[model samples]
Target chain A: MGLNTRIEAAISNAVKVGQAKFPDNSGAVPPRLASALAYATAPGGARIRPTILTSVAMACGDDKPMLADAAASALELIHCASLVHDDLPCFDDADTRRGKPTVHLAYSEPLAVLTGDSLIVLAFEILARQSSHAPDRVAQMIVTLAQRTGMPGGICAGQGWESEAQIDLSAYHQAKTGALFIAATQMGAIAAGQEAEPWFELGARIGEAFQVADDLRDALYDADTLGKPAGQDDLHGRPNAVTLLGVQGAIQRLKDILGGAISSIPSCPGEAQLAEMVRMYAERLTPVVSPQSVPGE
Target chain B: MGLNTRIEAAISNAVKVGQAKFPDNSGAVPPRLASALAYATAPGGARIRPTILTSVAMACGDDKPMLADAAASALELIHCASLVHDDLPCFDDADTRRGKPTVHLAYSEPLAVLTGDSLIVLAFEILARQSSHAPDRVAQMIVTLAQRTGMPGGICAGQGWESEAQIDLSAYHQAKTGALFIAATQMGAIAAGQEAEPWFELGARIGEAFQVADDLRDALYDADTLGKPAGQDDLHGRPNAVTLLGVQGAIQRLKDILGGAISSIPSCPGEAQLAEMVRMYAERLTPVVSPQSVPGE
Candidate 1:
């Protein structure tokens, strides 16, 4: 199957596992919650993190496709869960996400919290279900996932940065956006039986590039174009590449980061292909950069 | 170590795991979040769930003591996480837990949300960290934790019920309170490499007894006695055994349930001792009960 198809199928299967009854025949949850789980995930967008995970696994020889699928789904679920919680009234209070109403906006705030929580638990369950097959790899996968999802260096830490008065730009960006990318790459390698260490720089670079691209988009596009609140960094007086580096400088920074990401690919059978994939992501990431704007691809 | 010591240490170890740096040298999370996580769990009241887990594991011969500790810690973390989230303004809106300011009140709503989210993640991470030692047991532990903490029949579902106009008392109690009890018994067994199915009834009966005991306490005791708010069920117009059965009937129900809990202990190496523990728990659960209130104890 194609990468996208596989990732989508795996995530769907994981969600079903959660929606299904526990093995001991416990009671079913409320319908609204089950549906909220679906609503929080459906109409999927770029599927960026899982795609990176799948790509990294394939690059690492893809010894265990099932493990890769489970890891990918688990990573995406964490990403999705973070978004659900971040959009709460206490945080971003975002009205929409992925161009639709945020989980809290669509469902009540309580369901939103529970939904985020259920998704987090469901992610671990997805990994555990695959454990017996590859105990060592699954164990590592679980640890890698947990590391990237929580503190002291996970996305939860990223959200916590928002509430603080003095923000460390690099730390904030790393936790907020880079942590999951680190998870995506590291988990992909671990899923395919590779050491997570070597892939760290590649994931970090890609994450930095993505964050820069996001900043540029938020700066350049209107809310109609961005599909959510735009100029949020300026509005909140938050740090961003566009503010510090200027438009041209930030775009150049994005290019430089992507270039670093491609070069940072560790040796593998599919190393060349992975580099090509990173290139393609760069193009997708910088779609607004015209031929003259970037000077060269 | 005593069961209480083991549980407290394991929980402290688990929280430390969340606070410490990831192995890959990522940025450290904010201190406030780390502090909030600690604040949410300390001065813990009862330590009831972990104690039950420790007892059950001991009853099952706890071949892997560390695994038992991890499971106990993981279960308690989820319970603590639920309390942190449930105290948010969107939910119970309480200001205190365990006789102190709630995590949200002390740490801000955003941190409380992140603290709960981090605690949930940390719980899985704790189980995952133990996977290398006993992959099979830890895998089952992870799944059991997930099953008892999330939907379709976990505490998240229990919370979800409040959002619904119609409440199913059995399902609500099972998900909200019984889920973790089920996890305690089942995980204790799973930690010792025993089958999870046999312990389900014991956990369920114990959970029901505890719920009834809780209802009786909430009805009979005042806010000072309960520590947090009292009569919350009545305040929120939520369902409870006291409302359905009256105080005497509820007390009687608690006695019947605890008696059933004692009888439901699955045959194990420490079956007699486990039964004694349950009997001891009954006294603790119904402290206000006079000798005449529960005859032939």
Candidate 2:
């Protein structure tokens, strides 16, 4: 099968694993909370982050299903947790996500909060218990995950930076978006018993490129095509590449960053495929001549 | 200092460490979210868990300020995160905590959710970066903390059980309260390069005793003395020991558990002080002349 098809299958399998690992939703206390967790984690998206993780793992000469699954699953859990919290009434107050009502909107605010918390803790648990890598490697992954999810340069810091300081657009994007992406790549490499510094840098650049593309999409694409709310940055008064560098400038910078990311990957078994996927992702970000004919379409 | 005075000082120091660690309360794009996090975490209640953690650490023969402070701070952060989620409208819907309005009540629900999420991540960050122990020990601590905070046997499962299963009082108390207590003792011993199994059992028993005492306090004490609203368990229809075992039976159980806990500690260099502290705590649990005679009182 092609790389795209393989990635899709991997994501589907990861989602199944994530869902199966959750508390049974049919129980008595209230199915809503578990349902919300299931709902938020189901209906899988592009699974770009997990794909990057697994791809990097493959590039490092480790195709072991267990290692790939653990790394991908851990990244997905973090992504899902971030989404749940991001949609809370305090953050985006999002009513819809991935064409369905967000967790909080579908359930109650408390359930959403708990579901998010559960997911965060579950991410670490999965990594600690399931990884086939050495204990030290797993420990490194856990520490990296925690650091990226917490303060200074993690998601929490990324989220908090918006309120506390006058941050540069690049720095903001790096923290908010690049941190997790960096984690995904590094974790993948670590899972395969490879040093992660080079891959970490590559992932960070790709993440920045992706964020730029996302900023452009938010400004130029419709909600139907994006699968969620669009034009929210302006609505929330958040600064983005679109605001800092303008449309054309942001697109140019995105292409440059993507190229840099692809070039940064060391020549390995799956390097060609990894580089091609990055190119395809970049191309997918461009405006289509036919509105419905996006590349991922 | 007396054991009580020392415990109180340890708690205070832990609170200071936690607060200092996350001093910045500003968000990157939305300042309100950062403010919400600060408000939620800053004015916390008595840092009882941290005290327990440091006490255990000290009892294990590692009394370094740095190690004790790191463990204490991390535990408090986890507790704070749990409280934030618990008080959300969908969970407990509590408006006040420790005499102040809860995070959701003070800020918007979305911000409260994000704040809680941030704190959870921060807890792991503190452990990963600040623990003054070997890397493997740090990893073990992280695993232990994550397991207790996550599902199945952790606080997550405890909360989930509240919604779905008719949990036995012992199981409920074990997961919800005892897990963290076990973690505190384990972390303490781990910090001292000591075995954790015996301390883990001791802490778990002490935690069970503490929970029973708390239930009694809720059933028999007044709100003014408790600080927060009383009879919350009854309001929520939670099956407490007081309800299932009866007040006198529960009180007797508390004493027995405390006695077992004190006896469980293996004789060590600091065994006497640890035993003394346990005795003082057990004595405090006896039917007091006034509710204000409780530890926090």
Candidate 3:
């Protein structure tokens, strides 16, 4: 199956398992919450993180596809859960994501909070269920997911940076954006019975490139074109690559990062194919905007 | 060491591990979010959940003390995280808990949200780290923690019931109150290399009894005595045992449930000691106030 299909299937299966009726079939996941899990995830955006994970796994010779698949689902779920929480009133309060109402907008704030919380819990649970296939791998993946989802270096830490009075741009970007991408690559290796350390650079480069690209899009494109609110960093007085590095500089940095990402791929059976995939992503990622079209330029 | 001491140490260690500086140690966790995690868990209330977990683990011959400690920390962290979210402006909006300001009240709402998210992630990470000690057991504990923390039958589902137009009281109480207690017993058993099925009854009964007792306390105790708002369930128009069954009826039900709890202790090496612990808990849990003390009685 295709990568998106695989990710979609795995994610759907996880929600099914989580929302399944009880032993006595008392009820099904309190209905709305069960549905909300699906609601928050469907029509997935780009499926980029899991795609990177699977690509790295294949590059490393995915000996256990099941473990790799679980890792893919796990990584994606953490990403999705972070988005849900990031859009909450306490945070971004974003009403639209990928052109659809945010989870909190579609569901109430309470359910949205629970939805995010449930998804985070379910992400770990999904990996744990695969322990029968490879207990050690599952354990490591759980750790990776948790590390990339939480503290000093995870997405939450990324979000936490916005609240800080003095933000460390590198640490903030690393935790916020690079952490999961790093998880994607490292977990992919770990799941495929490969070492995790070598994959770090590849993930970090790709993650940094994506963040820069995102800043570029937000800076250059209008809401209708980007499909979500643009110039949000400026609007919120938040830091961004475009703000730190002038537009041209940020674009140049994006190019440099993406170029480095390809070369950073550790030696693997499918290394060539992984590099090609990265190239394809780099093409798709960089916004196709003209200098004349740049807003306020 | 005493159970309380063990629980306290385990919880403290887990937070310390989560907040520890990274390798090469450039920057620590977003200081505010890290501190909020510690702030939210300290001066803990009864700590009934983790206490029950450790007690059960001991009862079943905790051959792996480290695993049991991790499980206790994981379960309590989930409980603490839930309380932080539960007190958010969107949910219960509780200003104070156990006489102190709630996490959100003390920290900003955004920090509170990230703090809760971080704690939840940390809970699973705690269990996953135990994988090196006992991979299979750690995996099971992760699954157990996720199941009790999330959808279908977890605390999240319990909270979901309140949002529904038609509530299922038994299911509500089971998910909201009993889920973690069930997790405590089952995880304790899993940690000790015992089957999880047999311990469910003891946990459910204890949890049910606690919910009912909580209702009684809310009804009988004043704000000064409770150290938090009194009559919150009634004030919120929430469903409670006392409301469902008259005060006397609920009190009787509490007694019956606690009695069943003691009897339900799974046969194990520490069975007698476990029973004594339950009996002691029963005494501490039951409100000592009389009918006259119950306002509007």
- TM-score leader: 3
Candidates in order, TM-scores: namely: 0.96, 0.81, 0.98
Q: After superposition, how far is residue B254 of candidate 2 from its true place, in Å?
A: 2.5
Q: Which regions of candidate 3 deviate over 4 angstroms?
A: none
Please give, for residues A137-196, the per-residue lDDT of candidate 1 as tens digits. 999988888887888888998888787877766678888899899999999999999999
Task: State the DockQ, from 0 to 1, for candidate 3.
Answer: 0.76
lDDT of 3 at B90: 93
Docking class of 3: medium
Cα error of candidate 3 at position B100, Å: 1.1
Error of 2 at A136 (Å): 3.6
Q: How accurate is candidate 3 locally (lDDT)?
A: 0.88
Q: Is the docking of candidate 1 incorrect, acceptable, medium or high quality?
A: medium
TM-score comparison, 1 vs 3, better candidate: 3
Score candidate 2 by TM-score against the native: 0.81
Worst 10 residues of 3 chain B by lDDT: B20-29
Model 2: lDDT of residue A8: 53
